[model samples]
Target: METANRIVLPAMDMNVSEGGEIEQTEIDHYVARAKGGAGLIITGACAIAFPYGAASMKEPGLSDDKYIPGLKALADAIHAVGSKLCIQSTHHGKVARIDTANDRPVLAPNPQDYSYSMKAMADCTPEELAKMGAATAGKQTTFKTMSKEDIDWLVETWADAAERVAKSGADAIEIHVAHGYILGVFLNQRDNQRTDEYGGSLENRARLACEVISAVKARVGDSLAVIVRVSGEEYGQEGALSLAESTEASQLFEKAGADAIHVTGWGRNPFDNFTDGPLPNKVGAYVESAGHIKKHVSVPVIAVGRMLPDVAEKAIKDGKTDFAAMGRQLLADPELPNKLAAGKPETVRPCINCYLCVGESFFDDTPFCAVNPSLGNEKVLPLRPTSASKHVVVIGAGPAGLESARVLTERGHRVTVVDKADRLGGTMWFSTMTTPDNERLLRWFKQEIKRLRISVKLGTRATGALMRELKADHVIVATGAVRPKPDFPGGDLPNVQTGDTLRAMMLGTATAQEAGFVLSTLGKTGRLSGLTKSPEFVRQFTKYWLPMGKDVVVIGGSLVGLELAEFLVERGRRVTLLHEKQQLGLPLAMPRRWTAVKDSEAHGVKIHRNVKVDRITEKTVEWTEGGESFSAPASMVVYADGTTSAAPFAAELEAAGIAHDVVGDAGAVNYIHGAIHSSFKVASEL
Candidate 1:
């Protein structure tokens, strides 16, 4: 194994295996990780038994000895690249949706109501519940409660599966004892309530987990390493195990024969666990939990929580943990370890933690990385460079343009990036400044550009003449988009500002102070501290400009409008958002969009949907709402309708006969994901 503070790609639901057999494509996925310099990989959760233990139908299994060959093939592929492979064995107790179990009732430590409280295990007849309980005891589900004889059989069944895995030539085995699954329910006080020896006190509650570890170790012995995965904390629940309790549980498992501990955390919301907190950004956020256990146990501690190399290195340097276990980061770039080891960490694709990968898992059981298009398809797509040489010019320095330049340069292309703006990151420079979390995107752009050694020229607008002057073999246009302000009566009136112009003024790139103040007063009474920090704009408003302080109305309900309203509201402005659509920020995704709407409403931002603004006036806006003509008083009005491609140089490129591609909002007004994906795709062609 490679001896470095590198990462171990943790098990995730890839949904590639079928009926305990490894698919060739799945084999390729693991092989690519090995080739990418992953020192170790833990395969997705593999069921040890049918129905009860299976987390999903697409998951692999080791219940039958027939799966040995497929397991062997998977192991051999990783071994070929000098990497170790492990299988994660899991049993989804109550959390296993009954729908995924072929209509069979899910097994849990105890019968409880689901979150919605609409479903309960008690809803089923006593006889039916007993049948499931008996099945867990290894008997046919024809009886109530498991007989003593049945319980003995199920334990042996677990041992039998472990023995089979040992003979399958796997390097290690991880017990999935977290995430509200079977073992998790037993360990969590909120779930388990058995009066018997299997529940109650901490030690009693840990009985099931300890038993599984002992059984697996007894069957496999020192031949294969045994790891226990546990959640550090259960969020959104009361009386759940805290970090201390989780540490205690980890220690118990270590003493029960587990060779390692993989620490994770459970959250009510998906984003909470992956990106919402400092834990996700802090390398080895779980290290403290592991450190607590490490202090009491001899077993190795594995830390996982969206770990980056810098954080990983710091954790190791501080002796906080033994290994860095990364899941999403690996999905973004499996070669993370190699990149770090070579001191080329900037090349690692950053995981934005948008949860697109998690969304894919729910849709198809096959997880896909938003940033790394080759993730799930790595088995079929060649990830290595096809050619070593090409001359390329990337137009536009937006996320798409920079991403294209980065990828092309990595493929051994000579790349020159040009943009008309005075800096890289077309609209992103403004977008990032909108949210604290988004600032990382801007950091990523600058870091990647410097790492790739691609030539960059700011303030150099791309033209057909420019491409020809550079003798570019390939050109990529990522000029992005411009704010679209459709014709409205008095559209050209003073103080009628577009979102882009306001952004420019906020960033101090333009001297539109009067327009900025007018827009600011439209949203807030007078407080604009949260919207921007342009001292000059603030001073101009406090001095020469008149603060409308008048009731203001805004047109459009897109993201820009919502944010602008928020800015205005924070500044003590009375703001009302008017749109023709029924919903605001229609392009936003669910849950997040829902949350944004709630936040907007919390700020007292009025929404007049199914309305149209027909004219702008010095002190009022004329509009029709719900089929009635009306006018709303306004000191200033800002339009955040949408955007359109702004590639004035496209004609120049056509005239110069230069081959090029338009991407990002410049090609089609969209979000950042589209822009980066488009850039990467086009860059790959180059």
Candidate 2:
């Protein structure tokens, strides 16, 4: 492939096959990227062998010649738009579970005896370990490992696959040697422990990978370019190769005749370098890893870590790396390169890094970008605008409203956005104030709205009179919902307040000193003391108010409650979370929720499940835990019980016979995705 100032759309699992045949959905998905003007389109991981190589049952396969025709069609569609295509060949190692029903034994570099019972590496028997080692050396499975005799066989398999891919008309081939898969295991010391020629040292460990590249190169010659994807850092263990070690491996691969190196970092550890951090971490963070390897090799290096165009441009301009390979960014906006080239970068949708794409791959077999609704729906939804022009009125400036407005405007509609608040963002304004990390999201929203040029009227409520005057052809009521506060005993007292009220006060909207004696009751000391303090303290106080004082008790230990308690305890405030439920953050995913719980526990936050708050008196809260009555003194009572719509305009909209839609907290309390999705749907319909 010619080295241009363009980005390569890297392969991501887009589950678009049934019975190993390319579905039309897959074709449309790749074609969209090609049409969007991507220089190269890398198809998602395709299995080299059937049940053994497949990561999931739904993943597409190129295990047999029969799969070639379907792949040919995908290549044709992409090529029609003048963009080159590459197909990634992959084999899952121990990550593949050996099902007795399938009658295939899972293969790994070394034996792994740890299953459901084993916690660490010590749980394995010597015999089982030996069997595993033997199996890796070409034993039971139909797809045998490369012995000296089997070396030709393995080479032939790759050569034949490459030839078939060439016949299918792809421009390049990428060897999947990352994410702890088959080839990756052979490279990492944690997995490959063989004392043999193909294991002990870094050179030995890299032998299998080099052999695969050599085989593929010899078979295809210089007719196609070969790219190797490598994990720059393996998360947990010290035995794993670092950037310097991986650079040596890259040198070996380059000498073995690879065209380009695509660098990535992975493993189970969340905080590992290049794996975890903020949005900036996602952009250009892995370029240094690529640079380290690039210095040792002659081939071009591709940098990938949630790259946006500006970031990717900087990397290329600064000579950090040769080309930028994008996965999530392309998923978010397939036409990103084209848009950037056309000087219309604002039209691109940014990836929010919500992990919804990763979550979908486990179940649906294909990744779905949250911000880009067209993802996974490529077969059904047209990427280009099809709707006829119409005047669409989107009420509210929340995420949903903004998304709806953006989509509608893009679909050749005249969009007018109105919000009761004096600004674009609704609850997000206050919600985002809680954390500095989340401020980027708000900035993204602001940037997108300004770029779209959608006319927005701030502090303007949608009414029947306004609707009639504007003569909107369609009305999208994304006014949003409110946080519900049911009547509780003593709730109407001056000291009692809802979550929104506290948030608003702490956010500097409502003066804490002016909110009557309630502020004084919370141990404010004086009027100005609580109201006019540092912005950081206000943020901390608003989000997790309990930690502002010496001792605090939090009611309703849901996601917000638990996070608040955790934050408070971390800030040196003693916290006791009282929840009526059996578990905390029940609505959240098990992995994230459990991780939060464990971290919170580690931070010394006391958790009391199956507990109910009876009432709150000025300085104390009464509650029952495990059916026993308990009382705790409070410096301040913080409500993290979630929010309900506090906007009074909804009833007025209904009373005035105005057509409007309520979304987010107004329709019901939900997460960021809910708000964005709801708004998109409403806007699309309008």
Candidate 3:
């Protein structure tokens, strides 16, 4: 509770809790951050009540005294490490999935639309569905609109939760009224159509928030700091809480006993709120929202959403708000505060805005980072020095190989990473041409390799002879995948290339597709890339500046194809993508799939699915859709279909009788998350 810095580690659901008790994994996670020097650490939101009000059983609970001991242990762990701990309490209303509590009713101000959680509750017994709170899936199940008695019970629940939080040794209590949860549901005029005292005008609509605050304050008094999270502007729903209404709500909250106002944005769909517990929209995406609320409130304000250290520090220095809350950034690196204090931001692995953490946490309580695989396993998996260190040779420079090398070195092994390219990132580097945010990941990995003093041999394609010459104890074959040679008539024409080949040529790195066996020439590779002045690389890629003509035909409709189409369109090229599948993005999550299709369409790329390529000439491509055949003018044809293992490379290692294991694309090709996770598992074992 005492003063430190203004940095706040806001509550993020760390899907590790089980049966309403915090798991040891979750305890270890918070303790790791507390040791890393966060000023304040807020536990993931705990349920104020059971079954009906709780979001997920995997999330910790404060609904009863039985949960106190686990909360106490979590608090003591952080307190002993010199960090203040806060517990967030919530009632999820209709959003409650009730995965474990099939007997609890789904309550809301009014009947709401369907959600993933409600659908899951449908499989409950018919007897259970008849309960006041039970839900049945595959059919329309409306909410049990809260009665005045229900509202009073919720108020008492908050006060009880706050008392329990204080007894558990938490320094502060934050009421969850943001992100379309139960409390937020009551605040939204659109959701609450009640003619009762709790609904109607702005002040009337906010009566529940003020009442909850007053009740909580009356119970905890001055023993705990009270904070309320609110949506400054609910953009997602019609006639939801607006900035002006929420601004007035903030004043009323302070008057009712809130010590701080936490501002967040809302989307039309409560499940997918903008920029919080979601992929960050942009740097300081919610700063303006916080600033607006801050002007109207006397209490301290916390601004969140993809805030970098420099940006957070500046906000404090400029007095835009009192505290900066970082969720995903801290999840990426728990030592973020220490890194900033030590002025070593480059060493910090940045979040790539991938919604894996969010998607995982919501669907299953197993949130993990895309760039940092060590997350979510802080208690079990480790990088402790091996009892007997082995000399390790890694045969790729992509994410998988890089991760293997990093962990191998941490295990006190002498590590050597060899790649055929002059860069550290394998295909991930080529991906940065469209997604520049991930470019920093390459830097972080390069920095770690340098810090650990691992040997990196770029432009050195590992061969059996090379492995034998190294006399290594162990070899990790992450040689990665290669583009398939899909045969089409006249495909051998000069303008035809795979997505990888085109990307490499454009980035000033001549691909093996073009340069052939010479890619094996071992050249001095640096961590930094300077394409504009590298004479050798520039000369090799000179003819590739305009490799494709204006009109292009992409031969696949996979994720790779969609991305390639976007990149091509950004460079003023007209693209037509042909795929055998009915959908453009096959086997991707809805968020990722929708984004790919949206960006592709926004770029005006023509897409024809269920099409079979008939033939390709130097200047045109003939393809069939349904039962119809058509020919289109195309000056270039690019392969975006798929890839197969770099099989020969692994076979060479096997033939030499060497002790090597293949990870990632060399064994399996599942793109980024799969490749990184596979490498982490293999490297940890090594």
- Find the candidate with the highest TM-score and give its number: 3
Candidate 3 per-residue C-alpha lDDT over 562-611 given as tens digits, one digit per residue, 9 for 90 to 100: 77787777667888888877666643433455556666877888988789
- Positional deviation of 21 in candidate 1, in angstroms? 2.6
Residue 361, model 1, lDDT: 47
Evaluated against the true structure, the overall lDDT of model 2 is 0.68
Better of 2 and 3 by lDDT: 3
Winning model by lDDT: 3
Per-prediction TM-score to the true structure, in the order listed? 0.80, 0.82, 0.88
Which lDDT tens digits does candidate 1 get at residues 414-491? 999997666666676656433333456666778889876779998676666677789888777787788855588976
Ranked by lDDT from best down, the candidates are 3, 1, 2
TM-score of 2: 0.82
Error of 1 at 40 (Å): 2.8
Off by over 4 Å in 1: 1-6, 98-101, 117-154, 269-284, 379-391, 435-438, 472-474, 486-498, 511-641, 644-648, 655-657
Give candidate 3 misplaced runs (Cα > 4 Å): 99-105, 113-140, 270-278, 380-382, 488-490, 507-529, 532-547, 582-589, 630-632
TM-score order of candidates, top first: 3, 2, 1
What lDDT is obtained when candidate 3 is compared to the true structure? 0.76
- 1 against 3, candidate with superior lDDT: 3
